[model samples]
Target: MGRAGDVAVGVVFGGSRVDDGQIAARQFLLELWHRDQQRLARVLLFHRLPITLEEMALQISMARRSRLAFLSALIACWFGASAFTYQLALPGRKLVFPTDHYSHPDFKTEWWYYTGHLTSASGKPYGYQVTFFRFGLRDKQDVKSQPLFTDLYMAHFALSDIAAKKFTFRERIQRGIGDKAGAATDRYLVWNENWRVSGAGNDHRIVVSDRGTALDLNLKSRKAPALHGDNGHSQKGEGEGRASYYYSLTRLQTDGELTVAGKTEKVSGLSWMDHEFGSNQLRDDQVGWDWFSLQLDNNSEVMLYMMRRKDGSIDLHSSGTLIDKNGATKHLTKQDYRIEVRERWKSPKSGAHYPIKWRVAIPSESVELEITPAFAEQELITNRSTRVTYWEGAVQVAGTARGAPIKGKGYVEMTGYAGKLNI
Candidate 1:
């Protein structure tokens, strides 16, 4: 693995330096997180929703009468915390390297997401996603107890077998206590037990195993990191702080071994990586989003998210980034593109309807694409962590760009369809 800087000696939050008080504050925050977990469980049991407990907790604002108290406390622990405790993702912030590839403990939320399309030597096509999320319980400086760790780590790994029309997924959550799980700030290393993404610079390795399925991949960037929306400040809402520092490795050459159905196969393909960190990224009126990451055969990629409002209109702040063959990026605003759902699939497991097919049009760029899922049932019912049921799967793209026919594979993520993704 390539090392960036020294292992930040001690705990650091966001870009802030850490002290003893910060350690105590993080410990206190963990206590809050633990209590909130229990309270959230009670709220879910009391409300008895078809949704996952994690989703129920996030949707606590809509809880029934009996669970209001517990929900309120949980919300307080998250949104009502002292402002001094955490750093907000604001405009004009410069994102630094290697360190930025790791974790930002000072930010309330951060995620490293990897999605790819692969084919076995036998030509069996597949799609996979591996994501690691770090949720700050409290800033180290805000903790009152000297705990060894402060952040909570959660990971999701999924594999999509296209021809078989099957999708398998697994999730894990860890406290990061005693090295059980955590991320490195001085380098690019994030892990939850054995599942991890570690690298130096733009080269990385991803390893995940569950049940009879596994992926051991080496990823090398083929292009520079593409910063989205105003140089990495991707806005989601109308006001300030409703944004995130988002960047994507639009193209990564992937080579690895994948074990599926008890058979291990060597696979090579293209992958995409997105790393984002921010706090207070959404407005109260926003409910959910439809995000697309498309890598076309034309040596170009597009990343777009359409944020939906409670009133059913699309948020104007919803934007995208387009990466050219040479890694040049162009910012795309709401007016630059349009997304239309072509089909909906109802999940028998959750009784929720989700859009399974879509049409994306970027007229200004002469881009129009029809996206279809590798399978209709790629919904992840994350009961272990994040508790929200969302559809995130690999997709096949067929459309025209610049008046030329093009085809490729990509990934699509739909949130707030099963339950409100308050987080």
Candidate 2:
């Protein structure tokens, strides 16, 4: 037998001739099988292997004499040597701009998030959020069909009417069915129906219209993308691949139009953009996370996330990044900063008790801040899309930076209050 055939035999029969490549492939396939049998079947069937049913039956018959060998050979034949592999987020993988901003289908999960505080021409204040998500269903290499079923696309659009004391949001979910919904691999364009975000270089545009609420905004980065945790590999839990390639455009000059309740007004503000992608992130014991993105008036920014475990302790791998006015970044470990909950809010819809107020202090940076929600009712019950009940809202920042009085606006996201987040 040739080398490929020999490797296949070793993988199926546990032969002594098994090479390192065969062993790795065997482990990967087994892991995939254990995670989701239905997903594995989809992966295998879509690969379109040339093995005929008669050939497969012969192989199965030969292995039937040994039950262990039969199971191994069956998996090996179904998975095939050309089985696709998803890419994992690992250390030292440098991110390249524009290219990295585009869709990364090799990773299992990715998101493009934009949040900002906007002020209208009429002096009315508003907070807006538009997010696009891509969840890989199967690797592109495994698909031989059109209208690629390789990914599922979802989006969320929300507006916080501070004056009206109201929060309105919309959700969308769709398969990559034609051009109706998909993210481009060669460019930075992602959309779900009419809601879309596209850009080139540091300039971007976002548009979303649902019902009478809409946001047509343009964003230009005021700073370069800040790499979080060891050059964009943000660790979440205690294991290999328990991390994500994370970065943020900490400051984006935003301007456009905002329409609410049939009133359209020109708006301008500062925005934050985060793009993260990875194959695996959360561990089974990790319940969820509390994420903060603060933009201070001093032109500096702080991004922190605390991964909460089932045992009610924070994971040591939870870390953050500090961006200075000049676009420089400094990584912060859990021990470097302190976050204390000052108050909580119980959602009337989901009953999730979320920490609505926080006192964040970073002694090394000489920063102390109190974050409070602009309004208490920004929680989203995303049953129509992500099916996740979480609180994502605009917040007011107050306190001191380097002993100088400072204040700003930001967004806080709290998940797992209703239930453990699946992703």
Candidate 3:
């Protein structure tokens, strides 16, 4: 559900009609729900298989096709296990809140995502994100009698040094089977050994230091609840149960040390955190999403996303948030935004082209700015969630703020651009 399909494509191939393209994409999505997104398929299932989707197709590249197929197998194993139970479809009518936050086991999956842009002691930029995903095996809470029957908690953390042109990444998968790795509710703690993101009281800390690389972050927010529109009913497509509960904590006064390569330095900047969960988040006709959360130089922030259909048009309800410095929030519906990919990168792995550079236009304020990622190799390949890979990287924001020189830091998450993210 990450590819909001807002970015433009140089050429829409798969089908002559947008509907045809969407149908194909949706088919690809549905098939993957069992194998890829659900984490039902594991590495052992295909470790013996040598097929890597490296061919070229008129639709997407062979790498994507193979990835989609491989991902489907992985999700099937992860979700179809005996540990989780699901509600399948449920009513999503309430505004999602923190108290409402946690694993929606009834649903296929959920993730708590945290990303920050920080500056090192000597004036260097370092960015990183820590995401903890919980997948309910059978939608049934784990029974205490069984030792191996437990849901899976997958953690992915990465560090990007903008000027260094390199990345520090690590991924871990632990079956909540026991206490090797687990998430707690009464207090904030999710960890597996030395790597953990924990907090209680009013403060949060993400500590994951391994093999000399780590992200020791301290988070404090300046804004209240920066919620997504429809009263937290984030519609993905016009269909039954095609929505999610999405919310964000924008503009966190970030202070911590980003350790990468081999050094740890004190850093301070702005950080953003997003927590979203729901049952059946994808529509039959939707492909993916293009999500961007930016902290503008004027002290105001914009959180915008485009949910795209297979047919190339946008889902009118794939909205965003506009928060002012004073902590007030504005609902930005589908009409007030226009985000496009001005440049692209053809990943050597999948050979599927991804829009790496973008020009975002917000007509309401007569604003036009270019947003681009600091690196294109931020695609992560994790076995815990499946072998599916996607782009999640730090971005450099540059443009004029009301005819003045202003720059900022943020992150751009592009999905479906390379192919369906499966997750």
Candidate 4:
């Protein structure tokens, strides 16, 4: 349904100005642009244009600098101004698996996020995060002259060596040139460079390798998917389009191999996966968010996110979801819970102060948690791709539920602390 039709037409009529390669290439850029993937759309467009062999070298040099300069300005124009043209995440959205697990081109932004805390056979603890993002540039039908696909694909992989108190992360961005990166729409598969995540049924595999760290894990969901908010229509703000279709597989049994410093070890643990998509989510007044995905020892999971305003108050739209052991979900509004910062840590690299310790409580549910980080420094400086600095780290949760002592591991994400999170 993409460039295949254009390719067939060009081949049947023989090569011309609108040959198969030209049509396909243009469509590729158009698709990216249409989806609001402006940087990649412009990068590939600059690279794919015809150039004489003599001038190719010069053009390449110029293109490199131009692309860099253009991308540097991306923070000002990241998601295109086509929010009205794209489909918004309104209420009453239905989510079908296999299809929804892949990519959503109609929406402006989508992400497949996985994070877990693992323990090696030797008793060493580890934490990891692998996420794939699809950013749409423009609508496909907008390309009138040539078939163009203007979408950008980005992925981030991180591993935390809790014992060593070290965290490593890598970020990548691709224009899908020559099939180097892409996401399958019919199935659960997303990849960039050598990193990939593929799934069938409730079983998923994550493979990521970079520098001296690698993670190869197989995750099988132990419970049904938990729909967040009103039937997965998660509201981020009071505006019409400030929402998203959000769901999570909060408890997945994980097992596989992880390589650190050239040493591979067998590991097993529980993972949490969050998939959300929509055209617009954060409102203009919202600056950032603090998100927690906790998997308690009691087989229960809690997903909470607080959207923070410039005045340091939690937005009214902040909410959460409680996934019971039976896989049933209960929505929690802003007033249902409280998050008190017990301690804060400042990052030396970014000079941003982030709360590393939190006192979290849901009085109605009788769940109280003291969230502490495995390490104080797990910040990700993603200047290469997303161009945002944020903290995503393994956390230890200790507290009580219904008067019963409980403890577990989870992940906490704090954004806008390093800088204003644009997307």
Taking all chains together, each candidate's TM-score versus the true structure is 0.82, 0.80, 0.74, 0.82
True-structure RMSD for candidate 4: 7.4
Candidate 3 matches the true fold with a TM-score of 0.74
- Distance from true position, residue 228, model 3, in Å? 0.9
Instruction: Write down the lDDT that model 2 would get.
Output: 0.80
lDDT of 2 at 113: 97
**Superior by TM-score: candidate 2 or candidate 4:** 4
lDDT, candidate 3, equals 0.64
**What's model 3's lDDT at 160?**
88
Candidate 4 overall Cα lDDT vs. reference? 0.78
Q: What is the lDDT of residue 179 in candidate 3?
A: 40
Q: Which order, best to worst by lDDT? A: 2, 1, 4, 3
Highest lDDT, which number?
2
Off by over 4 Å in 4: 1-84, 139-149
Pick the winner on TM-score between candidates 1 and 4: 4
Better of 2 and 3 by lDDT: 2
- For 1-423, candidate 3 gives per-residue lDDT tens digits of 101122111111111234655545544544443343234334312332211122111235455556655544533433333543344433445643444443454465667788888888999877888888765544433222121223456778888878886777788765443244555543456666567766543357878877888878888867666767666666676776676667787777889886666777889888888877666777767777878888887888888888777888888868878788886878877888778778888878667677888888777766678897888888776644445566788988888756777677788776666556443
What lDDT score goes with residue 115 in model 2? 95
Q: Which ten residues in a row have the lowest lDDT in candidate 3?
A: 6-15
lDDT (tens digit, per residue) of candidate 1 on 322-393: 899999999999999999999999999998899899999999889899999988899999876877789899
* Over 4 Å off, model 2: 1-83, 139-148
Better structure of 1 and 4 per lDDT: 1
lDDT of 4 by residue, 97-200 (tens): 76678777668888999999999999999999999987765543321211122456788998899999988899987654335566666567788878889899
